[model samples]
Target: MSSPETFDIVVAQLGDNWTLTPVVFENEDYQLPDTPAPFVSVEIYGDFFDQASIGAGERDDNLWREGGEIFLHVMTPNGTGSRQARQYAKQLVNLFRGQDIDGVRFLDASIGAGDPGRSFSNYYAMTATIGFERDE
Candidate 1:
């Protein structure tokens, strides 16, 4: 069998706020440096998806199994980089939340390029995936 994927799982119960478990996922790309902008993308990603907590299940080969994906792009003034591309990707996931018929998880976040000189233009993109358990 393939190796299992370990992720930083966050769970939101029936009424309480979401909780971030201490268990660290095998993937550490999601952890970002403490930036001045504070990488508000995290907040945006979560709020955009209305996700209260992280997923609570294993991932399949599909894009998402239970959790969703959020993309964040930091663009330059010239608008020439992977920043916008990445943001667009996250937007794609946000556009289609709670609509999956298969009930799979899709927490795949990717980043693009950044403008080396621009202020915030130092573009960067981020995606957050949320996976949930399959119901009987």
Candidate 2:
């Protein structure tokens, strides 16, 4: 598999930490459960940057700085308080706060305070965006 595909799988595995909600990964033909339940949506974004050169004659083309964020959207019932969702976010934080998975060194995680606007009448949602980087 290519690097992006490998990264995608690595990020998807982090969603496994959320056992309370079903996970929906990107690139899959999927829809949230119809019964108004909690669920997780996962997407991966990455890029490679050129490394600064310090030598007069060296192969700099091979040096690359790669990184990305694992964007996870956790959805829960709107009427219910966000305690469960926040707890889930905490679980995610614990999973990736400062760890490396498949060469992706996770730097930190950001949990959305709360987003009622992202919710419909029946479900409220929050986001946990985990940032990671690697140099190769």
lDDT of each: 0.32, 0.70
Using all chains and alpha carbons, the TM-scores for the candidates as numbered come to 0.24, 0.77
Clash statistics: count for each candidate = 16, 0
Question: Model 2: what TM-score?
Answer: 0.77
**Each candidate's root-mean-square deviation in Å?**
14.2, 3.3
What would the C-alpha RMSD of candidate 2 be, to one decimal place? 3.3
In candidate 2 the C-alpha lDDT for residue 53 amounts to: 50
Model 1: lDDT of residue 111: 36
lDDT of 2 by residue, 18-67 (tens): 56777777777766566788877776777555574545465764556666
lDDT of 2: 0.70
How many backbone collisions does model 1 have?
Answer: 16
Candidate 2 deviant stretches above 4 angstroms: 1-12, 15-18, 52-61, 113-117
